[model samples]
Each structure stands twice: as C-alpha cells, then as structure tokens.
Target: MRARLKRLLPRTLFGRSVLIIVTPLIVLQAVALQIFYGTHWEVVSRRLAAAVAGDIAMIVEMLARHPGEETLAWVTREAFARLELVIRLEPGAVLPEEPDPRTGPAEAELAAALAERVRLPFRIAWPRTERAVEIAVQLPDGLLHVEAPAKRLFTGTVTVFVIWLIGSALILFAVAVLFMNNQVKPIRRLAAAAEAFGKGQDVAPIKPEGAEEVRLAAASFNRMRERIARFLAQRTEMLAGVSHDLRTPITRMRLGLAMLTPRLGEEDRAEAAALERDLAEMEAMIEAYLAFARGEGAEQAQPADLAELIEEVARKARRNGAVVTVEAEPSLVVPLRVDAMRRCLTNLVDNARRHAAHVWLGAARSVRPSGGAAVQITVDDDGPGIPPEQREHAFRPFVRLGATAGAGGTGLGLSIARDIVRAHGGEIALEESPRGGLRARISLPA
Candidate 1:
C-alpha cells in the first residue's frame, strides 16, 4: 500500500503542483468536520432538548403545588413529547448508563460522560412508549432526577449540521479539481512542445507563464535550444567550406595524372591510375561533407514535378548505357529545393545503375498511420540485391556493397540523398526490389 502511494506521487513539477494545491484543502476540510461535530453538535442537540426538561421540571413543581396526579401526568406527557429527555439528573449530578444494541454493550463515551461529576446524559425515547408506560426516576441524596419519553429524537441541530457537512465537502472537492486543472496546464503545454521539437519539427517554444519557477524553467529551455542551433549552424558552415575547397586540389591532381600517363610505362601508368581512384574517393567524401553543411543544396523550396525529375535522371543514365525505366503519374507540385531533389534522384539512379542493368522508378500514394498520405517515389533495380539486414546501412556515408574501393564514385551518394529528403520532411529507405537489386525509396508529403 505504501509503495502504491509512493508511485502515485508526482515525478514532475506539474503533478507536484496539483498535489500541493489539493492535498491540504482536503485535509483541512476533514479537520473542520471533526471540530464542527466536537464543538457544536451536542450543544445544538441539547438546546433542542432543553424545552422538554423545562416542562418536566414544571410537572414536578405542580405536584408540589397541588395534590393532583392527573395534572402531573398531563404535564409529564406534554414534556415527554417535546423534550426527548428520559432520565435527567438535577443540577450537580451525573446520569446513569444505558445498554447499546449496536455494540452489545453500553457505549463507552456515554458511560464516561455519565460518570463525570458534571455531565448528565438523558435517554431520549419515542412518543409511543410514553403512552404504553409511565416512567419514574429515583433521585439521589444530593441531586434531583426526572424521567421523560423519546418522541423528540430528531432535532433541528442534527439536520443543520448534516446539511452543512455534505455541502462543505462537495464544495471543497470541486475547488480541488479546479485548482488541480489550473496547476497542470502549463506543464502539459511544455511537454507537447518538447515532443514536437524532439521529432525535429518546428514548434513554438512554450510561453513562460504561470508560477515563478515554471516560467524560469521554460525560459532556460528556450535559451538552451537557441544556443545549440547557433552552434550547429556554425559547424555546418565550417564543414561545407573545407569540403568545397578540397575538391579543387583533387580536380587539379586528376588532370596532372593525365599529363603523367603520357610519359610513364604501362605498369607505372596503371599504378598511378590506382592512386587516382583513391583520390576520387576522397573527393566524393569531401563533397558529401560540404553538401550536408549547405543543407538542401542551398536552394529555395518550390513546387516541382518529382516524376519528371526521376525520368530526367533515368534518361541521362540510359544515355550512359544504364537500363532504367520510369513508372510515375502527374501529381502534386510539391514544395522542394530543386537542386537538392535533383541531387537525391541522381544519386539513387546512379547507385541503381551500378548494381543492375534495369532500374524502375515509380510513384505511389501511401497512407500514413497518422491518417495522412505521403507521396512515395521508389527506385527498383534488377541485380544482386542488398541483404535485408544491410538495407538500413546502405544510406550511411562511405558504405558500399556489391562494389569495391575503386568503384568510380564516392559512397556519399545515398547519404546525401537521405539528407536532402529529410530536409524536405520526407524519408528514404532501402528494401528488396522486385528486380532483385538494391531499391531506394524516397517518400514525401503530397
């Protein structure tokens, strides 16, 4: 039980706020109930019963005044109906204890009160009992006693307190609920904004509103995000510049190799050619680094024909002896940086061409789990396909398969393709193609 309560305790500020605001209110209400009953309940009930005691006192006095048993009986009966008093000790003494049916014994509180030198508890009974039997009390040596009946058990005091307790409890509970909701709102908003930010989507930072500490926390988080963004931007700029500069040296060296080939022997020329292959790989890596830094080819996003782009890449590859086909329909003029989209398509097409003689480019609309649809552009190839386990690894930089060190290009092709697609809020994945070769799929929102 303790462990369950501990688990229910708040692990967050929002939950703590709700607990803080409501817990004390409930406790205070409970305490107030105890005090209300202790302080005024009996006093009120006794006040309602006082009228009967007066009537009984009058009856005893009338008997002393005149020798008339009928008058005495009439006064006693009237007193019994109004005041639920059965046995009331006169001033200065206590009343006797009576049996309680619920406990199979006398109530200890009742016994204790009666035993007190100052308290006198009267037994209140029903009106019908008065008509059945005449009650007589035995007075003590130093105290007076009177007997009465039970018709007046329910007094106005009991009704008033009952109504008050119920109403107060209900009002307190409603106030607690409202307080809990108000306390939890700010934190709930922060959680939603943080989740959207984690997914790398645009989200407005939560406004720093509410309690003082909550506002400070939100302000800190917003500041931290800004710092990290600036750092990433600077880092990207550096990588792009360095990568872009290295390409010039690599280009000049490749041209130098052409000049050297004319003067060297066939064996030496072939060895130099090997070095050229390594240089090309370095060039590709540098290009990928730079492209990642530039972000979406540094092109402004605009509506474009994805099918036409795929067909254009395929046609270029076909001119270079690649068997690639396109199977796509005219659809959305989507928002995309043209240069980045072109680069992604070029990489996928080139990679496909290297693996197979035939590559099929197709488009389809797929439903998302979120009740939305995505525009899917697929590349299918017919060659030795990538293993299922390695499909996910294919998009990593410098990761190559079914091809070697000197395979004529940097492995950055697919990596750059993925980056570009992601920048447009899309995705790329490798899977088995019907043609048995590596299939690269790019999905975007339509």
Candidate 2:
C-alpha cells in the first residue's frame, strides 16, 4: 500500500508541495460548505419564514375584526401598497383534501409558524410560480387568500455565503502557490548544479538562498564539490609528473639502443632490439596512464554533431586497414565535450579494430524512459568476444582478458572510455553483439 501511494504521488518537489498545501485547503472548504448548508443556511431560512408568517397572521386578524366590504378593500389595498402582498377574499370556498408532505426545512418552518399564529382551517400551497407561497385560511362566510413573493421567505444569504467562501479560498490558494514556487526555485538550482558537476560539466557556484535548510544544502554541496575538484587536480598533477619523469629515461634508453645497434655483433644487436621493444612498450604504458588520468582536461560542454563524430572515428579506423561500417543519422547534435567524447569513441573503435577484422559503428537518437532525449552509440566486432563474466573485469584499468592479454595493449582503453562516458552522465555496457562478438553500448542524455 505504501509503495502504491508513492507511485501515485507527484514526482517533483514542486508538485508534491503544491499538493500538500492544496489538499488540506480543499478539505477545509468542503467542511465549511457542509456547516453552512446544514446549519447556518437552515437557521436563516427559518427566521425569514417566521417573519413572513407573522405578517400574514396580522392581516388575517384585522380582516376578521372588521368583517365589512369597505374595510376588507382598504386592508387589501394597504397590504399591496405597503407590505408587497396580494390579499383577496374568496366566498364559499373549500380547503384541499390533502397537503404536501413538509420535507424541506423552509416548508417545515413555514408550517410551524402558521400553526402558532393562526387558529383557522388553513391550507398552504408552495407552487412553482412568481409568488413563493399561497396560504388559504377559511373564514365563516368566505376564505382569506394571501400570496407572498419568494424573496420574502427565501433570502439568498446561502448563495452569498458560498460565493464569499469560494472566493476567499481561491485567493488563499493563489498566495500559497506563489510562496511555494519561490521556496522551491533555490532547491531546483541546487539539484541542477549537482547534476552538472556529477557529469563533469563546469557549473558556477550556487548562491545559498530560500529557507535555512535549502541554504545549508547549497553550502554543503559547494564544499563537497571543492573537495572533489581538489583531489582530482592533485591526482592528475602527480600522474603527469610521473609520466614526464619516466619519458626522459625511456627516450634516453631508446637513443642509446639505436647508437649501439650499428656497432654491436648479431647476438648483441638482437638483445638490443628486444631491450628497445621493452622500452617502447613501457613508453606506451606511460602514455596510456597519463591519458586515463587527465580526466578530459577541463573542457566545457558544447553542441556537436554526434553522428559526424562517430563517422570520423570509423573513418580513421578504416584508414588503419580495418574494415569499418558506419550507420549513423546525419546532424544529431548534442551538448558534450567534443574532445572527450571523440576520445571515448576512438578508444572503443580502436579496441574493436585490434581484435576484430570487421567493425561496426552505429549512432542514433533515442528516448529515455523518463521522457527525455538521449543519444546511443554502439561499437560491435566479430572477434572472439570476452566471456560474459569477464566483460565487467575488462573495464578495470590494467585488467585485460586472458585471451587478449598478449594482444599488445596497456589494458586502459575500456577503463578510459568508461570514465569519459560516465563523466558525461552516460553509461557503457558490454553485451554479446549480433555479429557474434562483444558490443560496447554507450548511452548519453542530450
């Protein structure tokens, strides 16, 4: 039940906040309406009905005491002119056999009011006409018929009350929405900044604002970002220095080996050549380590054609005598660090070229489950693919598959590619391709 409720809830903080504020407001308004209609409105209707019934009793009493044609005419004329009531005298008239079932409060109130004030055999008719009520009180010689306007007994206080209640609720809701939006804006900015940082994009420092908790969160995020940046900077500098120091020794050894090669005997020259190969492999390893540790070098994100980038990588691989097939949409642009993304694709393509005779590179636009746009690039090869269990191990730096360990690589290609892809808020997955080899799938948000 808890999980189901969570699924039904609004996803964003802003939407949930508004729901929290408005839910109670709606419940309160409903309660207020119930009270007004059930109690206040009924009370007001009863009071008005009683007042009108009293007026009718007084008119009937005056007519009974006078009992003459001139007096009756004067009373009817005076009632019409002053009280806004129509009174008439009907001679030799009978009452109805049955009366309406007194259901509503207004009808009940009028019936009780008439019984208390008048002592005659009277029948009341509440018809659907201009006049609200018709009271026919029987007299000895005739009958007294009185018609009163609907407004007299039923004042529109309930309608006015409802309007005032709804209007005030609407005003309060508008104010709540405005306040909630202002409160949520700072939190949204904090989230955006954090996401960008996680994706290795350079974002400006967030200025703490809004509520105290939001301000505290922003401050904490800034501190964490600074610490991570400092750590990366220190690590990159250390690796760069190591690479620089090692390169000097390797270069000196290479030159010395070349100088001794021309003067040495066949056995000595063979030994020197093997030593040169070792030195060259060491140089390649150092270069790979430096490249992996550089962290793409503070390159800002810019819109670039992803399809073109893929095609270029494939073209380069093709030039190196690899059979490369490219299938990519034209002009699929996305915000990314061009150099970093290009390097990542080149690494994947290069790795494929090393083990496979036929390489397939594919790029296309895709949609994520969250209704956002994404770009997917796939590199597949028809070589002897790594075992499913070992595919994950291949992504670890310096950890190569046993089958491909002797294939002349420093084993940092997949690791470096994964690092760059992940830095751009993307993922790299290895799976069995349709081509009977491994597939490197890269998915990046646009």
Candidate 3:
C-alpha cells in the first residue's frame, strides 16, 4: 500500500512539497469544521433557539393573564409590532399528529424551552413556504397560534465559518506554492549545471543561493569540478611529456637502421628489417597513446550537421580502398564537439575497414522511453565479429584479440572512441550486425 501510494504521488520536489503542505492543511480544516458543527455551532444554535422560545413563552403567558377579548387583542398587536411575530387566537384548531422530519438542534432547543415555560400542551410546525416556525399552544379558552421567523432561531454561522475557512486555506496554498517554487529553483539549476559538466560542456560557475544546504551543495559541486579539471590537465601533460621524450629516440633508431641497412649481409639485412618493423610498430603505439591521452583537446561544443560528418567519414574510408556506405538524415544538426566527434567516428570506421570488406554507416534521430530525444549512430561491418564474451574486452585499451592481432594496428581505437563518446554523455554498445559481423551503436542525447 505504501509503495502504491508513492507511485501515485507527484514525481517532483515542488509537487510533493505542495502535497505535503496542502494535505495536512485540508485535514486540519476538516477537523475544524467537525468541531464547529458538532460543538461550537450546535451550542450557538441552541442558545439562539432558547432566546426566541423565551420571547414566545412570555407573549403566551401575557395573553393568558389578560383573559378579556379586548386586552388579548391589545397584547397580540403589541407583540407583533415589537417582536416581528404573528400571533392569532384560533378557537377550534387542532395540532398535527406528526411534526416535520427535518427536526434539528434549533427545533429541539425550542421544544425543550417551551416545555419548561408553558403549562399547556403545544405543537410546533416548520413551514417551508414562509421560512418561519409555527407554534400552537392550548389555553383553557382556545389555541394560541404563534409564527416566528426561522432566522431568529438559527443564524447560519456555519456557512460564514466555512467560507472563512476555505478562503484562508486557498490563500495558504497559494503562498506555499510560491515559496516551494522559489526553493526548488536553485536545486534545478544545480542539477542542470552538473549535467552539462558531465557532458563535457563548459558551464558558468553557479552562485550559491537559497537555503544553506543548497548553497553548500553548489559549493561542493564547484570544488569537485575544479579538482577533476586539474587532475585531467595534470594527466594529459604527463602523458604528453612521456610521448615526446620517447619519440626522439625512436626516430634516431629508425634513421640509424636506414643508414646501416645497405652495408649488412643478407642475414643481417633480414634482422635489420625486422628491427625496423618493430620500431615502426613502437611509433604507431606511441602516437595512439598520445592521441588517447590528449582527449581531443578542449574542443568547444557547437551545432554541427551529423549527417555531413558521417558522409565525410565514409568518403575518407572509401578513398582508403574500403567499401563504405552511409545512410543518414540530411541536415541533422546536434550540439557536439566537431573535432572530437569526427575523430571518434573516424576511429570506428577505420577499425571496421581494417577487419571488413564492407562497412555500413548510418545515423538517425531516436527517442528514449523516458521521453528524451537522442541521436543514434551505427557502424556495421562485414568482418569476423567479436564473441559476446570478448566484446567488452575489445573496448579495453592495449588489449587485442589473438585472432585479429596481426591486423597491424594498436588496439586503442575502440577505447579512444568510447572515451570520446562517453565524454559527450553518450554510450557505445557492440552487437551482431545483419551482415554477420560487429555492429557499434552510439546513442547521444540530441
């Protein structure tokens, strides 16, 4: 039951805060109404009813004491003029067998008061037509009929109380909504800043505002961002230095091997050629390492035509003697780091070209189940696909499959591509393609 109620609740801080504030307020109002009607209003009605009944009883007693027709007529005329009551002396009238079904607190109080003050039997009628109460009291001579305004007995304080209570509740709710919205706004800005940072987009520093907790959170986020930036900078600089130091020696070794090759015997020449191949491989590995370390170099995100980017990648692959085809929506623009995205796609296409004769590149817009829009880029190839178990292994840096290790390249391509994609708040997955080979799918928020 608790879980179901949680599911039914609003899924935002502002909405839930409003619910938290308004629910208790409504309950308190309802309890207040109950107390008013059950205790306070009932007491007030009874007191009012008793006061009206007392007036009626006094007039009846005055009529009884007068006894003469002329004196009774004078008493009736004064009562009507002063008390706003209509009194009549009926000689042969009879009371009804049953009273009205809508008997209430005022009627009960009036009946109790009349019973105490008057000696004779009486009947009361609440006639709807005139909105008044009619009382028939039996005197020794005849029946004394009385009509009093119903409003005299019941003053409708309940209606006024309800109106005030509802008006106050609505005002309280409006104030609560305004305050909650203001409180949640800072949290929303904090979340957006974090999201943009995660996507490798530069965001302005967020000013600490709102409550102390919210300000503290914003401060912490800013500190974490600075720390991460510093760490990435230090790491990139260190790796760049290592790569630069190693490259000079490697180049000298290549030059030395070229200079000495012509003077070597046949066996020595073969050995020198093997050394040259190793040096070349070493150079390639160092370049790949540096490329991965640099992380595409502080590229700013801008709106770029993704379809054109894919077409350009395909065209480059084709120029390199690979069969490449592209299917993309034209003029499909998305916010991306153009150089980083281009490098990432080039790596995937190159990896595909090395292993497969035919490569298929495609891009299209997609919508997530959670109602977010995204763009999906697919690179499919007709090569020997990695096994399901080894697919994840392919994404790790410097790790190559024994079967495909002789393809003449360092195994950092997929790793670098994945790093770049993930930096943009996107994901890459490997699956079996329709061409019976590997399929690399990248999904990025549009």
Candidate 4:
C-alpha cells in the first residue's frame, strides 16, 4: 500500500511543492462553502420565502372581508403597484387535486412558508411563467390566482458566492505555480552541473540564488568542485614527472646493455640477454603503472561515434596478430573522451586477444537500468572464461584470476577499463559469452 502511494506521488520537487500549497487551500474553501450553505445561505432563503408568503396571505384576508366589484378592482391595482403581483378572481374555479412536487430549495422554502401562514388549500406551478410562480388559493366564492415574481423567494448571493470561489481558486493556483518554478530553477541547475562534472565534462561555476538553503547548497557545490579539480591537477602533474624520471634511466640502461653484450663470454652473453629481457619487462610494467595512475587527465567529453571507435579498436587488435571481428550499429553516437575511451577499449581487446584465438566487438543502442537511453559495447573472447565468483576480483588492480594467471599481462587491463568507463558515468561488467568465453559489457548513458 505504501509503495503504491509512493508511485502515485509527484516525481519532482516543483510538483510536490504545488501540491503542498494547493491541498490545504482546497480543503479550507470546501469547509467554508459547507458552513455558508448550512447556515447563512439557508437562513436568508427561508426569510425571503416567508416575506413573500406573508404578503400573499394579507391580500387573501382583505378580499375575504370586502367582497365587491369596486374592492376587487382597487385590490388588483394596489397588489400590482406595491407587491409586484398579478391577481385575479375566478368566480367558481376549483384547485387541482394533486400539486406538482417541489424540486428546488427555493420552491420547498416557499411551499413551507405558505403552509404555515396562508392556512388555505392551494396549488403552486413554477412553469406558469419564465420569471414567476403561479399560486391558486381556494376561497368560498371563487379561486384567487396570484402570479409572484421568482426573485421574491431566491437570492443572487448564491451565484455570486460560487463565482467568487472558482475565480479566486484559479488565480491562487496560477500564482503558486509561477512562484514555485522560480524557487526550483536553481536546484535544477545545480543537479545538471553535478551530472556533467561526473561525466568529465567541463562546467562553469554556477551563481547562488533562490532561498537561503538553496543558495547555501549551490555555494558548497562550487567549493567542492574546485577542491576536486585542484587535487586531480596535482596528481596528474606528479604522475607525469614520475613517468619522465623513470623512463630516462631505463632507456640509458638498455643502450648500455647493448654495448656490453658483444664483449661478454658465451655463457655471460645468455645472462646479459636474460637481464635485458627483465629490463624490457620492467619498462613495460612502469608504463602500465603510469598510465593507470594518470587516469583520464583533463580530457573533456565530446560527441563521438561509438561504433567507429569499436571498429578502430578491432582493427588495432587485428594488426597485433589477434583475429578480431566488429559488428556495430552505425552512428551510435554519445559523448566521450575519445583518447581515454580508445585506451580503455584497447585494454579490454588486448587482454582478450592474449588468451583467445578469436575476439568479437559490438556496439548498439541500449537502455540503462533506470530507463534512460544508453549505448552498450561488448568485447567477447572464445578463451576460457573467468569463474563467476572470480570475475569481480579480476577487476581489482594487479589481481589476475587463476584462469588468467598463465595469460601474460600486466594485470591492470580490467581495472583500467573499469576506471575509464566509470569516469564517463558508465558501468562495466563481466558475464558468460555466447561464444563460450568471457564477455566484457559496457553501458554508457546516452
């Protein structure tokens, strides 16, 4: 029940805020209308009905006391001029056996007032005229036919009250929506800036605005963004210095070893060759280390064709003596740091090529778990797949699984691929491939 209610709720702060403002307003107005109709409106209607009925009763009594042609003519003129009533005497007419039932509050109130004051058998017809009610009262010598204006028993206040309620509610709702949109704009801007920054896109600092709490949050976000930028800059510079310092000595050592190889004894020549191989391996490891430590380093995300990138990675793997095939949807475009994404795909492809005889790459449009549009990239190999339990462990830096232990690698391939993918606000996971090996799947938001 709680979950169902949550699903029905507004998904954004602006919508929820309007609901909060409008709900109580509606309820309060409804209560006010109830009280008005139950007391003040009803009382005014009853009083109006009583006054009209009392005037008609007085005319009936006067006619009964003085029954003559001259008196009748005088009473008709007085009733028309003073009471706004049209009256006539039918010499021997009879009342209807059954009168029509009262259907409205005004009709019901008028009928009750006549019953209490007139004290005579009569029938009322609302259809006698468009703007009047016909009342016929039975008398000893004749029937008294009276046509009373409908306004006598009904008040204009009810219509005016209803119009006021509706007009005021609409005006209030419109004002609340406009005010809330202004209040929510700054928060929306903050959220967008944070998402862009996470995807490695450059974002300018946003100005603080709106209420005090929103302004404070925006200010804090700007400060945090600056701190992170400063830290990344410092780390990138240190990594560059380390790469240069380490490579210069390794190059010199390789040159010196080449010079000494020819002068060594036959057995010593084999030892020198072994030492050279170790040196080359150390250099490769250092390169991998620096590349991993440097991260994506100041690269900005821009629109790129993911399909083209996959084909490029496949082509490079083919040149490196690995059999590779690519099947990608054309123009599968998304924002990416081209070089960083290229390196990331290269690592996955290279790692696959070392152990498998065949590799396949694919890219296509997809959807993220949260229902957003996304692009999916897959790298598949026919080599022995990692155990399900060990796949996650393989993504830990320098932790090669037992299945991949015999595979010659720096053991940073999966780790580096994951880091790069995540920096682009994407996810990478390992799963069993239909090709009977491992599948490296990547999902990036479109």
TM-scores of the candidates are 0.52, 0.83, 0.77, 0.84
Worst 10 residues of 1 by lDDT: 100-109
Residue 5 of model 4 has an lDDT of 90
| Candidate 4 structure quality by residue, lDDT tens digits, 1-446 | 99999999999999999999988888988998999999988999899989988988999899989989999999999999999999999999888777566688888888899999999988788884389988888888889999989888777888899889888889999999999999999999999999888877788998999999999999999999999899988988898898899989999999999999999999999999999988988888888888888888478988999888888888888888999999899998899999999999999999888888999999989878889999999999999988899889999988877767767677888888998999899999999999999999999989
Taking the tens digit of each residue's C-alpha lDDT, what string does model 1 give over 76-139? 5665566544332344444456642222111223323333322333332223435321223333
Candidate 3, superposed: residue stretches over 4 Å from native: 42-156, 265-271
Alpha-carbon local distance difference test for all models: 0.65, 0.87, 0.88, 0.90
lDDT by residue for model 2 (43-123), tens: 888888788778888888888798889999999999889888899999898777786556667778888888888767787
Report how far residue 57 has shifted in candidate 1, in Å: 43
Candidate 1 stretches greater than 4 Å from native: 1-221, 248-252, 255-259, 265-267, 297-300, 402-408
- TM-score-wise, the better of 1 and 4 is 4
Model 1 residue pairs with clashes: 125-150, 126-150
Give RMSD (Å) of candidate 1 vs. truth. Answer: 10.7
Off by over 4 Å in 2: 1-4, 49-79, 86-150
Residue-level lDDT for 434 in candidate 3: 92
Among all candidates shown, the one with the greatest lDDT = 4
Error of 4 at 48 (Å): 2.8
Question: Candidate 4: which pairs clash?
Answer: none
State the lDDT of candidate 3 residue by residue for 1-446, as single tens digits.
99998899999999999999999999999998998889988888878777777887888778767777897788788888888788898876766667544477678888887888775688888877778999888877788888888778877777789899999999999999999999999999999999888877777789999999999999999899999888988988798789879998999999999999999999999999999999999998998888887886478788999999999888888888999989888888998899999989999998888888899999999995567999999999999989999999999999888667988779999999999999888899999999889999999888
